[model samples]
Target: MILEVLQLVPHPDTPAKAVPSVLCSLSWQDAGHWVAGFIVGAPSEALALPTPTRPARTDGLWQRTCFELFLRDPESGAYLEFNFSPSGEWAAYRFDGYRAGMRPLELADPWITSTDRDQFNAGMGAHLAALGLDPASIGTLLSTPMPEIPGAPAAPAQYVLNAHLEDPALGAAKTWQLGISAVIEEADGTKSYWALAHPEGKPDFHADACFALEMAMSR
Candidate 1:
């Protein structure tokens, strides 16, 4: 039997052991528009997520291939989870506690806004400062237009950060923390979970103990 591989999940396995799944990533523009990027090398005929004729709020989407978002308010201690199936069907739930006080939440697709160079850099600097970092300690910010690179995506979803972070929240990582994830469904109806960082022993997207991807802002 011949099996094709999907690049949606950033598995640690070698290409030889890579399974049929998609590699998914997401980027949000400072609470503006959030966009998801999926690296699906395998053709639809080979591997496809569930897509319904009419997209609607439906349950059991997670049992299949689906995109998800988890947002939380640190002050209010309330959070929301959103599920989006490739089929256009979606669902959302609100929780006042971990796996508690479940309720339905309404939402619409957020616009995908382009990040301007200046605005992006300024936001970066502001966030660093908010974390009590000296402006001089930070590396030189991107001050000019970036030259094109080979094999670069037609549109990039992530930013190229060359600065180092020295905070308790982020000891030295060079990326933002936000909650984003996906479940890739196999032809036989199996699934695997993927996220920015799964700290728990098992797959738990709602694990607010850490961030999948957190939005940063300046006061």
Candidate 2:
């Protein structure tokens, strides 16, 4: 596997650190095509938690490879950590945060095997089952309009919002009006797409970042 270094940025928040602020972009390229890759960067000084050996799949569009640094709290033997997905999502994990004696909650979804259609279906099926939902009933529920979440105003079927990007090292920045969408994919391999936008901007510091992608065939 050939992994190319696309971009690198020094850490702005911390100085005198051996690991200069780093930002990298990577992609999988084969047969003269770029499949998908994401940006990875160090977010803070806190140690990273151990990454799970089993990868997770989300929405069937992207695959993620992750790495973390783990730290421990002396008093409780419990710890807090930072996690980075090569696909660009960063999150903080606390062993005990929300409820008493509960496991940490993942704030984002990182899906793998986007190009493998069959695996995608199976992954989605497993997700639905975990939700205690019957895949067979999704169709009927979609046909009937449902009420909005309590205390929230109803929104249009579609929505739009502004997006922005900022990075001091690269001297790069962007502002744009964008649309959001969502879709449902059935067990039979059908899909639906929708659009909506959030008030917050989606910032990507590694937009132009680049990296090499390769797979090991055989010995």
Best by lDDT: 1
Q: Best candidate, TM-score-wise?
A: 1
Candidate 2 regions with alpha-carbon error over 4 angstroms: 1-4, 14-18, 21-47, 58-219
Q: Residue 4 in candidate 1 has what lDDT? A: 20
User: Per-candidate TM vs. native?
Assistant: 0.54, 0.21
TM-score quality measure for candidate 1: 0.54
Q: What is the per-residue lDDT of model 1 for residues 3-87, given as tens digits with 9 covering 90 to 100? A: 1222333423212122444454444333433455555434433434454334346888788766676666665556767776655
Total backbone collisions for each predicted model: 12, 14
Candidate 2 lDDT tens digits, 100-210: 353443433333222123333433444465568875656455334555688887542211111111112111122111111222222233322211212222322111111
Q: What's the true lDDT of residue 30 in model 2?
A: 31
